[model samples]
Target: MKVTLRTDVLTNNNKAADFNRELFESTKTLVVNIMSSPGAGKTTLLEETVRALAKKYRIAVIEGDLATERDADRIRAMGARAVQINTHGGCHLDARMIAATLGELDLDEIDLLFIENVGNLVCPSGYDLGQHHKVAVLSVPEGNDKIPKYPQMFMRTELVLLNKIDLLPYLDFSVEEARKDLSEINPESTLFPLSARTQEGLHEWFSWIEGAYVRCVRQ
Candidate 1:
């Protein structure tokens, strides 16, 4: 019975995900679902991303958190459209929650839509929000062992943004070890080490987004 309940929940979520995927594809909007453990700089990274890409793309963000509207507010201050989804004790934002928020934004007018999943390394990974890509953020402070410790999150995501690289010298983190572990777990996945604060290696991330956007539209 427990297994049955879990299956039913995901099955329903997948249906909603399909609905979202169709809507996103029809509008040619590039949707990226970014997930990470709390304080992995997901919001900071997004703030920087919006500031950098706003002129080139019509960017918007859907900020998911367990309670506060702080992250959404931060994105809006960057001059991008943002909507906050308070999960209210929910560890992850499911597909239906996203489908419900679509009406709040004019998807056709937006070229890039980023869904910042509720800060978590585990629960957010199992659910699909119909995003074109799923990227994970692992900070330098979080240490190198996280990739292997939380293999599910690393295994499922196509790209891993190694955030807070500015602290690399001060911290004991090893970027090489991270790349090695990720390769072992998910060879197809790419690890991008960057600092949202200093903008180091961030252009590579921006370039990747531009490429993703081009592919999203061409399809």
Candidate 2:
């Protein structure tokens, strides 16, 4: 019965995901779902992205959290449209949650939509929120073992943002080993190292978003 219930849930979620994908495609909105463990710097990275790219793109964010409108507030302060989804005790954001929130924003006016998934390396990776891309954030304090320890999260994502690299000198995290492990689990995935605090190596991240936007519109 447990298995049956789980299957039904996923089946329903997939239907909603299809519905969302159609809506996004019709509006030409490039949605990127960002996932990470708590304190992986997902929000900070997003704050920087908005600060730098808001002028060039019609950006909006869907912030998911177990509780709190704090993240959404931060994004809005950065001069972009943002809506917060509080899941109460839920561990992850599903397609239906996102689908339900879509009416709050004008998708046709948004060129790039970022869904910041509830911070969990495990559950967030399992649910499909109908995003064009899935990105994982791994901070320097989390160490290199995270890539191997949380295989599912790294395996499912196309890009891994290695945040907090500014602390590398103080910490013992190995960037090379992280790249190697991620390659083993996801051969096609790329690891991008950057510090959201200092904005080092952020241009590449912005460039990637620009490229994704171009590709999304052409399709």
Candidate 3:
């Protein structure tokens, strides 16, 4: 019964995702779905990404959280259009939720649309938000065990932004071990160790976005 119910839910979600993908393609908007645990620097990283690329590309974000609109406000402060989706205790943002927000933002004026999923490891990974790319944010303070522990999130994502490398000296996290573990779990996935606060190793992430945007628009 559980399996049947789950399958039915995903079927509906996928249909909604297809609708969103079609709209995104039509408007030439590069949509990325970002997932991470709470305090994993998802918002801060987005703020920096916006600060660096907003002038070159028109960026917009859909902030998801259980209760507050804080993340959306921060992204808006960076001079980008942002919409907040308060899940009200939901663990993840689904394709249907994303589809509902589409009308709130005029996709024609947007170059990039980033959907920041609710801050949870398990639930967020299972749902498809109809994005061109699904990226995961893992912080140094969260420790090395996270990559292997949360295999679903890492395996489904094409890129992993290993944030908080600036704290390498203060913490006991191992970058090489994370690389090894991720390679074992998802060999094709790319891992970038960056600190959103210090702006270290962020250029690679931004470049990835730039490349993806070009590819998306040219398609």
Pick the winner on lDDT between candidates 1 and 3: 1
Pairs in clash, predicted candidate 1 = none
The C-alpha lDDT values of all candidates are: 0.96, 0.94, 0.94
Clashing pairs for predicted structure model 2, backbone only: none
RMSD of 1: 2.2
Q: Which stretch of 10 consecutive residues in model 1 shows the poorest summed lDDT?
A: 1-10
Best by lDDT: 1
Between prediction 1 and prediction 2, which has the larger lDDT?
1
Candidate 2: where is the Cα deviation over 4 Å?
Answer: 1-9
lDDT by residue for model 1 over 1-219, one digit each (tens)? 344444565898999999999999999999999999999999999999999999999999999998988999999999999999999999999999999999999999999999999999999999989999999999999888899999999999999999999998898999999999999999999989999999999999999999999999999
Look at candidate 2 and tell me the lDDT of residue 64. 96
Give the root-mean-square deviation of each candidate in angstroms.
2.2, 2.2, 2.3
lDDT of 2 by residue, 113-197 (tens): 9999999999989888889999999999988888889999888999999999999999999999999999999999998999999
Using all chains and alpha carbons, the TM-scores for the candidates as numbered come to: 0.96, 0.96, 0.96
